[model samples]
Target: MEATPGASVATAIRLISRDKAAAASSTCGPGLASPPWAFDGAALPQYGPGASAADPAPAATPRQGALPSEYLEASDEELEARISAAKSGLGDRVVILGHFYQRDEVVRHADFVGDSFQLAQAAASRPEAEAIVFCGVHFMAETADLLSGPEQAVLLPNLAAGCSMADMADIDSVEECWEQLEAVFRGRETAGAAPVIPVTYMNSSAALKAFCGRHGGIVCTSSNAAAVLAWAFERGQRVLFFPDQHLGRNTAKAMGIPLEAMPMWNPRLPLGGNTEEQLRHSRVLLWNGFCSVHKRFTTDQITAARQQFPGVRVIVHPECPMPVVDAADESGSTDYIRKAIEAAEPGSTFAVGTEINMVRRLAAAHPEHTIFCLDPVICPCSTMYRIHPGYLAWVLEGLVRGEQHNRITVPDDVAAPARTALERMLAVRP
Candidate 1:
């Protein structure tokens, strides 16, 4: 299966850099609580009172990126050669971390392939690795660098790669919403009312995580949202979840919270555009956030597919709006999407709502089933689409030449407390 036609490398890189700059320059004063460049370093909260584990000393090795096309079109043998060269050149000094959503070609080269949190942990574990090559998006690399020691560098093979949903809840917007909420809740300690506990999804910035940490809250991934929500409800009467309303609503609804109990908080509105009574009565303030890519999927699309192909089952990501989710047969993470399709009976038809690349890849992987994106026009996470193969080649070769191009580094000051928040989430066992 072909990847949705990617933009030219220069165009893609320029677009991403522009967005990053815009994000950086934006005022983080209101509605958002994180800096565009926010990151958490190693000075994490010591979970134990004494004798916390020390990070291992970084191991030095040769430079990385000996081949250019190996990242894109290399054959299995050529790919092995590239990996062998990178390993032989860098030894323990380099660790390649891949996200679950990455292409198999990229995952094949990963020293570790897991979810976001898992990838960050892998980066931290490799104290000997001087350089970490991240095969995901900008946020993933930032998280890795935050988790890894300062001496270690986190390199993104394609700097253009980013998560669109992550960009939606900018720091300014979040901070502004918080202030509005704070104003509403002031001295209103009435019984049966919900107080605020901000719950951010893992697909957010370190600054957002820091905001959570500072405000006595925690972060959560899709798999652990239920557990995290349970934790939040224990601490406060009302919970504020950002960037992904679908996840927040789905998780809370599953926990027996009525739809009416979860009110959408529009950050664009004055006072979150929610009345005090609405805010006070609500158990969860679901942000008016969504994944543009996932939101494109609709009940109509699913119905059309089912009619076109009898016995078709619809599956979608939790980032999708609640209506689409309600219309689908199942919903889950990217891994879950792949697994559901893989495990489905042969000759089954599946309409998936998510990024187009992964959906197309799944279709190619399962020849026995009819797999299609819920959006027939072929929609992708435009930001993630920014990481074209050209940039990958350029970065890889640059690494080989010891010329670092796009290195995501989280400073010590921010990392210290940010790691505390991240560690808190990590410690919340399933």
Candidate 2:
């Protein structure tokens, strides 16, 4: 059974299993335990030591069976009831943090709904809560674990909910890039200026953040990227921004840095495929990475939105490509997008270039404003959408039964330095 386009790996597996079971029942033969589509190709890289983003291990069969059958077969009402009961039972012991990109099903159950940085701060504020259930991606769970108290357990409902862009810049690849940059700028540092200061986005792995902290670097979110870049320049001659080239380029460009000064670093290429002159003249060394969801927004979509709705204010996330950002009327973080719509006059039109779930929610929330996604094609953050209602029910039920499932714990060495970087970012004012 071929997977459908835009369908998640888990959804595809479930569909295949349902079809096979139905066919077997009619044929009067035993159903296959696993789907025929399961094949070993490459295993997903784990977030730990010696994990390589470039070289993938052999893939194992899909793990849809790992989810409890009861949860999968349960009706919406049943699942909702179970989740509500579990939340009520846990009460102050647990805090659920959901990102803006999460589906409405999961978002409705969250104690706090905000962007990644806001969610992390929310987790930190709730020290009394013993468990922090992060209804976001793997990196977010790790961040919550880092920010929350040591006694607090951070749980991610689905372990497969990983960020593709975050995986693009592994620790090893980034360290290699740093080594090459050091060689390039060996004798360039003078009395007042250092070579380059590293800055990792909040979407990156904990190891990358630790790398930044150890090297006198800081972590940045979309909300404070410009200010963070300004801080970096105060101490270093140049900045090595990573894991999302689009964000780095867009932020630097907004700061009046020339396009020629922001050179992209492709991990596959030697010295990031740039000449020595280009490296020396570069102000922001952007890693060649991007959000798969945001990258789907094209300038054509923006044009169509404007054509359809006259006076539509186009807003986009910085993770979008430079062309899309340039085409949009305004661009900022998810929180900024929400606030912009809130501040708009009644009956204002907004064409948002971000995840579809958030756009739809915003549209529903503010009926007065004509809010719509730039891309007509449905495109959600696939990894984030992996956290289905069934998974949420399963995890919540487990917690009710005194069991901790899918708890995300960062190593002490990694967490310590990562926390330092996070602290620096928290201290920075926009």
Candidate 3:
């Protein structure tokens, strides 16, 4: 029998690891066992069982309560039927928003599926939805809540499904970094412009978004990072971009910001490990954070793909390292990759450097082309895979009984400012 997309990816990895030592030991990390709920009660920080298993989960990452045995032990068939029936019962009362990085199992049930910002916009689009079931990570759900009506509760199927990359730049650390930067720039005001502007990536926490808003800064998605940076440059002398350093660096570099002007800020270090002069001269101060999944893509992978499939077009996410982005034929956001494949001529071969789930699904959807992940390892995002059918069943069943499980609610204080930053981002045309 064929396995579900969620389970099959892991199964494929286990089988491949038997012969291919490089794949098993690759940076993308080998897959883990069944029942992701096993890690629900884990004390140590962890993303449970998936590609990000090798990536260290921050100590502050949220943990989920043990799932009830009924849902945990129920067969896949039962969970699927229950979820379907529950959605049928809920009708227009709920809108399911699935992220592109999510497993195919959960994504099949999404009323609207897209990237984080797209899903948040979807949440806002459905005014009638009493609940927004975000089949994504914690930050994504928080975003949906911020954008959705106050009456509409946003529910995350699995509480443990939190983005590791987002957690890299916590609010406290960011505030500290901000204060240190202010101290360095205190006396060197550039007439009308502020010394630095805060720009939080969409993957960051809501508090960080609010921090940006309060600081006269803005929030940016990967697709609009360049445009947002341009907006920021008009308002401030320099940009302090957080959460995903690769996105900031790549976007700035593409806009003609030199490597010397873009400095990586290690938050743990005083002055972000920069001299006062370097900080003053910096055009973009990048936070030392990255997506574990995107970091797995290497220029070596691009080289191998080009050699193996001579005419293949290579496209990667800007979140990938600068070297990998430079090596690829093209680099853009997930939506860009999807659209590229959809518009390609039949029989076009392409190598995608994003999450393996998206690449695999795109490949299966567009059978005319040969589409594959640059990394040979089966790489479903660790947090994304956490929202399997079981959690979906649990959340939907609770909703069926008029109870909101794992609801994400941002306080009015944070929501207001965060929404401002988000609206500013919306105002900028990519």
Candidate 4:
């Protein structure tokens, strides 16, 4: 959905800086970065080979406080003990949510497993769940805390679990863009009232959600962007969608919003490259952001596959840029990408855009179709790489011993308003 107008851009910038600072302080990795139009090997590290199932897991550092010495070691037997202990103390009061990209072992323990949006809904619906042990990334845990009741505590097994794409759309950059847009919009308006709305993807932070709520905006997931955008348009004449520009562009374009009407807001630009006239005339102001992993996919890759294998249907995630999506036969969520390929007839070749790990997993699952990642180079979701099972046992063991580790609590102030934005999206019929 589109962003609501008059969300104070300056406030959003301060929020972004504070978020970056807080992330730097944590043991976990920084959150995801936005998607880029092109990849340069110099800035980004080469995607490493997938860690072997037989590879020794990272050993957990024992927490300084409580729990017995043997329990701290967290051997298979110790994990079994922790499982029994957790069952005894929490006893179905704790709900663990796992994302699809998470390792099999971690997924095995999740009481509810799905995409980020689904996980949030699952956490919010469980009134009896006193603690949500989110086995995804930091943002996912934060989402759970925001959605869950105040009495319930959300925990991230690994605080380091983060998404690289989410990191790209800093709150500071969003606020800066908004400030520039506001000035341009207000100066030109004969009427003093603002016309732009602020919309954020569900991948963003709770504070971002609060920003939307405070400014009369709404949150959206990939599955419901069209409906959300329709909601935003009903609220305002134009939208300033943050973080996921591709999602914004793709969704709006789907709604018949012309590409020229949806100019990107670049914080790096001196004045966001928009004339006062442009801001006023614009229907959608897409933030200059993207998913790093998905951006690795290229049009050249699609062309090469089509030439090499006739009738190869290309499927991709919407996180890829408009060009890549256009080149592909279809684009949607990771699940959607998988379903499209699975539905293809035998002897059909398929190219996919998303994390390499998932693509590889899908390739193995469906030997009938030739499934390959759109990017020739292997790229894992850098942030998701942190969610190894070793981290899982460490956090679970702490909970079993009545010790809180990596508790992700959204302050009441943030949660209160953030809930409003989220509720708006959740309330949508789609």
Candidate 5:
């Protein structure tokens, strides 16, 4: 990772600050001057640095307490040594799951590496382990907790690491919106007609998944959103999708649903900012939320890439806005992009629209082809960047000392139903 916004990137910023010109040229900068452990001390919580730096963290989002001084003060070399020692001591007792968006420094230490959907499935693979250390974000760890055995602990190195898209839809706001939807859809379920079905993206909180389960809804990942949408359409006349409106809208539109039939739900508005007639005519209600990261991609960027690299293949994540997806040569999940590159001809040039670290890694992995990110400015999922090597070392050392820190556990009430919705997604054949 040349200049990732992750721990190494943060460290580079800190180390180079003394050299004004060098620091100015570095990727780590004004957005991430401080390390992951040190917050800007703002009134509301923040996503440290990267794409979602400007988004306000929800009030209920987990706030990580300061890491011990030693972890912060230690050199990167020292932290790496400590993490390695702890892993050696724990052996098979602890398994670390890393998401594709994580930095190379952290990914090297992970036993399993994949996208969020793949990581969810991997969580259950090591049932014999005592702990599942998730090196992703808050929602991911919660999902791991819901899937892993009851006795197995799921720990997140940085509690503040959360998805901006996931935080956009809180349980309270969703509940309020659902009540209005019920009123709007009243009498629509008679004569064996299915009612509106809620479909939550896997990027949401476990509480939301539980909400779906209790309300006759289901969970979906970017890889399986289309399948889940199909499942919802089979049984329900209408669907309410949340978190990332781009993913919902993109997936639904791909299935030939007209833009006019899909409406946006503004939590602050009555009837989700829709007219009563529009609500009745709606086939899918997309929440007024989006991923700050993917939201940066534009049709302009695709056009620019095409002009710059004549035959460059443009592949983007579905989390991106519909226009960006439609403008590209192909659109799919993170896994899809990775696989497409892997299976491409040796001389292909790819302009990828996703996290920077992953794009850089893919480029490095297959040097025969030229690969680059659509956003030349290199913005990562700032929250994912929060899981610096220091945090991993701190948690790992605690585990070696027979202590657990930052363990994520969904309440029984939430877990039971959340599990059901997740199971429903699993039951669907992609």
Candidate 6:
């Protein structure tokens, strides 16, 4: 994965960033009407760091086209019947991949259910399927599109199902941040220090993944972030992490990297709002992005859970803020949290800090163990919740009719490099 020093890296960054920024900000976005799989955060729920749901529900999709009235008005039984019929008709041609955060109604229909990376791997494993119905957020669908065969179409049930945290670090902003870093570390590699390596989380857009690939960088998921960082350090003097500050901080901190060695990069400000000296001395440059659902978890909830369920083992996602992660008994990815609960003693109690849907489902599945979400408020991923069962029925029915609706396709130019980055990730033995 080591990239030689060259001008193409800088040139590619500038060109790709401009093109992606223009496309991303283009109008007539996704949803009921608009173009298929277009990203318009306006229609998405507000649930990022420092964001509150009290704000009016942003337009959930383009106003130009509305979901067909038939889908919305269909009775639950009718919708289920239609979904079952569509699946039967399509037979093995289609594969439904669901994220753990999906509602029970939609999840029950998925042929395979798992986390983001797991779902992507599942899609890759099923080369026989001509279509992949990804029941997850926009970036996840994009990942599936990149990983699956070119002939295989990837459909996102709800085009408006976009992640707010992923939107925070657009290709343009990341490129600008990189330019600032280059200015700070001028000729450092020539002076014996290796150049900084760009590391994006799996939750980012395909364009971001391509950016990493083009720049000789690699992508990391929650489960393998520590290993990815270790890989980065061996080849580079520093790492630039994005779209989730909490995960970057927590992972680096766990690796014994001091807090002062990790500086947050604010794209809105000049020089990422950090001094030249700070950027030089930093081991990890964290982007000012965070998950809304994970941020809702607090240390107080941990205390309350402990007080109520005495000896309850508290586990949380690394996406949570540092104090919350520090207070928890263990912090890992969603799959890690699930495995811990499944492996615990039958009568053991647990308090989990993650998306509410997954937590509630776990509680329901393992009645012998007392499991509850740390956040008393039902704060599911508002964006993930956009994948209603109604949308699933509509898309499946479309497939039955030989109509391609909301298919997520990454352009070949972008997919090539993005796939390289992902392949490098898979090669890492973490």
The best candidate by lDDT is 3
Taken over the whole model, the C-alpha lDDT of each candidate is: 0.68, 0.81, 0.87, 0.68, 0.87, 0.80
Candidate 4, residues 1-430, lDDT tens digits: the string is: 1112221111222233356664343212222222111111113332212212112222221122233345445554556556656656676777888786765445657788778988988998898977788877767888888878888888876554555456556666777776776676665433433487799998887778888888888998887888998988877789888788999999899899999899877777866776777767789988877776677678999999888878887888887888988888888886677677778788778877776656765776778878776776433464555554455665666676676677988888988888899889878866
lDDT of 5 by residue, 45-105 (tens): 8887778887887776678887888988998799889999999999999999999999877
lDDT of candidate 3 over 146-230, digit per residue (tens): 9888889999988889988898899999999999988888877677888999999999899999999899999998888999999
Q: How far out, in Å, is residue 384 in model 4?
A: 0.9
TM-score for each model: 0.75, 0.87, 0.95, 0.77, 0.95, 0.87
Model 1 off-target regions past 4 Å? Answer: 1-88, 100-114, 188-194, 345-347
Candidate 6 lDDT, 224-310, residue by residue in tens: 999999988887899999989999999999999999999999999998888988998999999998887798899999999989988
lDDT of 6: 0.80
Better of 3 and 4 by lDDT: 3
User: Per-residue lDDT of 30-55 in model 1, one digit per residue for the tens?
Assistant: 21221111211113221110001121
TM-score for candidate 5, residues paired by index: 0.95
Worst 10 residues of 2 by lDDT: 46-55
Candidate with the larger TM-score of 4 and 5: 5
Q: What TM value does model 6 have?
A: 0.87
In model 1, state the lDDT of residue 18. 42
Q: Stretches of candidate 6 above 4 Å error?
A: 1-64, 190-193
Candidate 2's TM-score: 0.87
lDDT of model 3, residue 126: 97
Candidate 1 global lDDT: 0.68
- RMSD, every candidate, angstroms: 11.8, 6.9, 2.4, 12.1, 2.5, 12.3
List candidate 5 segments past 4 Å from native.
1-29, 40-43
